[model samples]
Each structure stands twice: as structure tokens, then as C-alpha cells.
Target: MASTSSNKSRCATCGKNIGTFTCRGCSQDFCLSHAQEHRQLLGKQMDEDVILMHDQFQQCLNEQVKQPSLHPLMKEINEWEKQSIEKIQLVAQVARQKVLNIISKHTDNVIIALTSIKEQLSRARDDDDFFESDINEWKENLEKLKTDLNTPKAITIKFDDKMNSFIPKISVHKERPITERFERFLGDIQIEENGQLITHGNSNAHATVRGKGEYSSGQRLFRFKIENKRTS
Candidate 1:
């Protein structure tokens, strides 16, 4: 009777108790047919997982391959940007130098012209002073001559031995013309420096007498040339 009862309690497929036959691999209790089916399902699930892992690994490798190719291009672009910046800076520096050079030249020319004018003005003042002194001396000499002529002295004066007649003669003439004296003064004038003289306007021809022995005939011609150039 116990054997009969045990037989009735076992699974029909595997001839074992329904709960006693458990698969160690899957940790599930089942009849033989159901166990076999469960193993098949597990194997299929593992295959799907392996395929998914292989696909993911392939994707990672593809990404790595693309990165190596792109890296050199990115580096080249960065290097080009650096070189472009350097070239722009160099061009700007060259332009700045050119502007500075032009300004320096302009300033130098202005200084030279100003110095020339200043020197010419100084010479003109000296010439004026010399002319004034000469005129004063000439006046003093004329006054002395007048005083000597007015003095009265009685004496027997004979024009000819037969005719006893006295005649008073007076003559007045400039010992030296002012124009000729001025020209002589201009000729005596000299320039200390080795620069040509420049005149301002066409009002009058004024001699620029620098000092004692520094005047030149070329300076006089240069002044005339300046006047003509300005008028033209």
C-alpha cells in the first residue's frame, strides 16, 4: 500500500515526485519535459545576450577608429589658426612702423624749416642795426662840414694876378650814396652756417647779414629765387 501511494505522488513524465526533481543548473523544480524546455529557453536568452555584447563592442571599435582620423585634422586646424594670428600681428606691426616713419620725417622737415626762418630773421635784424649806425655817422660828418663852412676868416684872396676879385663857392654832395653803401654792407655780410638764405615776401630785397665774415653771393641769389618761386 505505501509503494502504491508513492507511485501516485510522483510525476508521470520522470517517475519522480513533482517537487523533488529540481534542475541544479536552473534551480527550478519541473517534470522532465518542462525542464528540457526551460533549458532551451535559457540557452536562447544567453545567445541573444552574447550577440548584443558583440554588437556593442563593434560600435566602440568604430568610434575609436573615427577618433584617430579626426584628431590630426583638428590639430592641423588649430595650428593654422595660430599661424594666421601671427601673420596678422606681423602685418599690423609693419603698418605701424610705416606710419611712425612718415610722422618722424614730417616733424624733421618742419623743424628744419623753422630753424631756417629763425636764422634769416636774426640776420635781418643785424643788417638793420648796421644801416642805422652808418646813417648816424654820415649825419655827424655833414653837421661838422656845415660848421666849418660858416666860420668867418678875412684874408686877401686873388683869383688871377691882374684881376683882384674874390668869389665864394659852395658845393654840397653826398660823400657816399646810401644805396651803394647798403650794397657794400650786404657784400661784407656772411653766414656762419653752411645753409642757403631764404626770404619771406616780395616787399623789399633785404640782405640777411649773419656776422663779420659769413655772407655769400649765393645767398643773395637764393633769396631772389625764393621770391620768384613764391610768386610763380
Candidate 2:
């Protein structure tokens, strides 16, 4: 009976004799010596597997820290900033060009008027026919030219207050409609407090002071508080 039983069962590893134990997990039978060796081999393999997985996880973490992906919204905001600045710069350039052109035209017109006056004065002096009236007229023309050169009433800056925009729109106007209540004035008048107030001097007692604006058709109301007045 003993010989028959021994022949019926054999060691899984060495196959030298009948297996003394069977593993519950793998369902493999092993002799006593082979069972201990199989347990050691499984423990070694478990350690190697743990080490490999740990290394892989660490590599993944390092990669994540080194090269993080930028958010989509961040890229979008950057592009918006670039485009907005470019647009602002372009508008600024255009404004500068317009101002230059206006200044050039104004200077050219002044020069032409000055040249005509100079020719008239030279001819009158050469012929010795210049009267007091001619001298007075030349003086008046020169004074008007000086005033026009100093104050460029044609150039007006407008701002769009109706629209709600990230950047406000500013425009330069050559012949804009007179919108403000008091913008242009003639005589010894001074504009103060950003055109909110006007002061007149009695430099010419007989000369009439006139405040004027070009309007096709409109009913306008004006209110003024006299800060100071001179009765001479």
C-alpha cells in the first residue's frame, strides 16, 4: 500500500517523491523542501514587482512636475493682450499722423499769408506810398496770424462715451460739429478750467467781444455765472 501511494503522488518540482503539501492559491502540490523554495521565489518576485512599479510612478511624477501643460484659457488671455496692445499702437500711430498733417497744413497756410503780407509791405515801402491805415492793417494781420498759429482751433479731440469698451475710443477731428456749449471765442478772451470757464479782458474797450460756433440749426441754452466783472 505504501509503495502504491508513493507511486501515485510525486513532487511538483523535483518529481523525486510524493508531494507533502499543496498550495491553496496556485493549487500546486510540492514536497516539503520544494514548498519552501517556491515560497522564497514568490517573495523575491513580489519585491521585484513592487520596485518596478515604484520606479515607474516616480518617473511619471517627475515628468509631470517638469513639463506641465498650460491651460487653454491662459493662452487665450495672452493672445488677447497681444492683439489689444497692437491695436492700440496702430491707433496711436494714426492719431500722430493726423496731427502731423494738420500741423503741416496749418503752417503752410500761415507761411503763404505771411509771404503775401511781406510782399505788400516791401512794395509799399519801395514806392513810399504806405499810409498809417496800411501800417495798421499789416499789424492786425500779423497779430491774427500769431494768434492762429498759437491756438489751433480746427483740431479737436473727441472721446466716445456711449460705448462700453475695454479700451475707450479717441478720435481727432479737423471739422467736427460744435457740441460743447462754449468752445470758441473772439477778442481778449481766455479759456480756463478745461474750457468750462471763460474770462474776458478789457484790452480793447470799443472792440466787441463775440462767442461763436458753427451750427446749421439747433436751439441752445447757455448759463453763465460771473466770477468777476469790470465796469470802466
Candidate 3:
């Protein structure tokens, strides 16, 4: 009977004797001696698989702490900063050229007027036939010309206070309403009123506009009001 019972069940590892203990997790039967060996093997596997993975994750965490700028999001922010600076430089270059051109033209006009006054004074001085009334009139004209030369009425510098900055602002939000403004547009579209208002610029053609924000998922809502319409 003992021989028959021992032969009926065999150890999973040794496969020669009856299996006394069965692992509830693996469902494999083992003899008393091999059961302890199987538990030891499981312990070794836990160290190799679980604890080793944890150590590897810890190393990644340490690297993140040392160099936060290595993140992908940081790279995107850096790119945005670089592009914003380039835009500012481009606008400044155009503005500088415009102001310089205006100043040159204004100076040429002033010099032309001054030359006319100079010729009159020179002719009168040589002739020596000018009266006090003529002298007072010439003096008054000279003073007016001097004032015009110092301060040209045509040159005016203005800043748009509604535009807080030439570069648009960015922020992070959790389900909060995001502000979207028109960025790039084609055809005859005009962005006005601090970027909140959009108006059609031309009556002849159609206009298309692209917004600043992009969304992959989530419900979004947009609102617009038609303030006025062009007649004809």
C-alpha cells in the first residue's frame, strides 16, 4: 500500500517519490525537502526581478533630480523662448529701419526750408535795403523754423497698451477655460481689441484664421459676437 501511494503522486522537481506539499501559487507538488528549495528559488527570483527593477527606477529618479532640464517639456519651453526672441529681434529691426527712414526724410525737408530762408537773408544783407518791419518778419520766421527743426510734428511714437507684450503669454491649467487667440491668418482677416475681436478686413475675398491653442482631447467651447456688418 505504501509503495502504491508513493507511486501515485510524484515530486515536481525530483519526479521519483510522492508529492507531499503543493504550492498554492504554482500548483506544482513537491516533496518536503524540495518544497524548501522551491521557496528559496522564488526568493531568488524576487530579488532578480522585483528588487532589481526597483533599483533601476531609483537610478532614473536620481538622474531626473540632477538634470531637470533634460525633460521633454523643458526642451519645448526652450524652443519657444528661442523663437520669441527671434520674433522680437525681427520686429525691432523693421522698426529701426522705419524710424531711420522717417528721420532722414524729415531732415531733408527741414534743410530745404532752411536753405530758402538762408538765400533770402544773404540777398537782403548784401542789398542793405531792409526795414524794421521786414527785419521783425524775418526774425519771427527764423524762430518758427528753428522750432520746427527741433520738433517735427510728423514724427510720433506710440505703444499699444492693450498688447501687454509682443510675445503671447502661456500657462498651465487643469480643466480651466483656456484663452485662445488668432495666431496665423490668411487672406483679409484682422485681429483687434487685444486679440479678442476678429473682423473681416476685405469685402472682396474670404479670410481664414488659425488659433493659438491646440487640443488632442476634451470638450471645448467657443463664443463669438457679430458687432457690425458692412453694407454693400
| Clash numbers, per candidate | 5, 0, 0
Taking all chains together, the TM-score of candidate 2 against the true structure is: 0.44
> Residue 220 in candidate 1 has what lDDT?
26
lDDT of 2 by residue, 111-182 (tens): 999999999999998999888988998999899899888777778777776787867877788855354545
Model 3: runs farther than 4 Å from truth? 1-60, 67-76, 131-147, 161-232
TM-score of 1: 0.24
The 10 consecutive residues of candidate 1 with the worst lDDT sum are 173-182
Q: What is each predicted model's overall lDDT from 0 to 1? A: 0.50, 0.76, 0.76
Badly placed stretches (over 4 Å) of model 1 are 1-78, 126-232
What alpha-carbon RMSD in Å does predicted model 3 have with respect to the real structure? 21.6
lDDT of 3 at 17: 72
lDDT of 2 at 167: 70
**Candidates 2 and 3, the one with greater TM-score:** 2
